[model samples]
Target: MAELNINGNRRMLIGKVVSDKADKTIVVLVETLVKHPLYKKYIRRRTKFMAHDPANDCKIGDKVQIVEFRPLSRRKRWHLDKILEKAV
Candidate 1:
């Protein structure tokens, strides 16, 4: 049913898979640049996201895209959308 699906924009992120030790799940590290309000210098900030990887296809250092999803576990709130690139 239409009601079963989310109807609004969802947060999507692109990051590199850092860990895949947990079955069907992955830890992705996303990095972003932010400019300091005062110093006006760009700084790198990184965040770790727990994402569902139903296929267990991701590997460390692989770039992937993920979409926000309803919480599947205590901390997993994102699901793998696609693998952008494989780690060499």
Candidate 2:
């Protein structure tokens, strides 16, 4: 199985839940700030991750932590670790 690093530690990411309509699955929008190589200006980049949420505890707008894992589905390679902040 593909692992995050040589240390066998899974990669962790923080993101906000964008969708939770699927059963036991939640879509998270992880945003990162990247600096342009030539311009040196930071720009916002966003990626959507299909994460497994066995408990179905996440709701839209909730901030959560996800950990990389073995493939749970065709596009799901991450699992919800914790709900960092409840939707408010």
Candidate 3:
């Protein structure tokens, strides 16, 4: 038998950290696309995710990578993985 890795199927996203508050919660903005039904064109969309910041090192406008995890709070289901770029 093989062990099922449920938690290991985490999702990773690259975005910018928009906010850090409430002790260890951070907000990340991820930009993606949505296909237009009629025109068949892709539209850009921005999504905000509330994630757990265990180390609390992220800041506003800082590019970061986040991964999906078990809910840390009522809203937080993602965790900070690493900072890809710093805010200027």
Candidate 4:
């Protein structure tokens, strides 16, 4: 829900960096609250996204912003926009 706009209509998402072991790639975990159809209760849903990190400046637990972009690999469709906060 903290999405931002940059470079036109591409989608943007905010998430936490869960993995940064890959050479120039980072795995971001985006979580959202979804309401159940019948239960009317909110459920935490998580999605992992492979994002391109050209500078490899991210680390695990870092909050980062990512924007949708052309696929760089079979699974990489997002690029690092900026780091929101650094992990302590």
Best model number under TM-score: 4
Model 4, span 3-83: residue lDDT tens: 545657888899999999999999999988889999999998889999999999999999999999898999999999899
Off by over 4 Å in 1: 1-8
What is the clash count for each candidate, in the order shown?
0, 0, 0, 0
Whole-structure CA lDDT of model 1: 0.87
Q: Judge candidate 3 against the unseen true structure and give its global Cα lDDT, from 0 to 1.
A: 0.80
lDDT of 1 at 11: 74
lDDT of each: 0.87, 0.87, 0.80, 0.91
Model 1 lDDT per residue over 1-88, tens place = 0011243778778899989999999999988888999999988888899999999999999999888999999999999989989999
Candidate 3 residue-wise lDDT, 26-63, digit = tens: 89988887799999998888888898887888889999
Model 2, residue 61: C-alpha shift (Å): 0.6
Model 2 TM-score is: 0.90
Sliding window of 10 residues with minimal summed lDDT for model 2: 1-10
Candidate numbers sorted by TM-score from highest down: 4, 1, 2, 3
Superposed by TM-score, candidate 3 places the C-alpha of residue 61 at a distance from the truth, in angstroms, of 0.5
Per-residue CA lDDT of candidate 2, range 39-80, in tens?
A: 999888889999999989899999988898899999999999
Looking at candidate 4, the ten consecutive residues that score lowest on lDDT are 1-10
Q: How much is the lDDT of residue 76 in candidate 1? A: 99
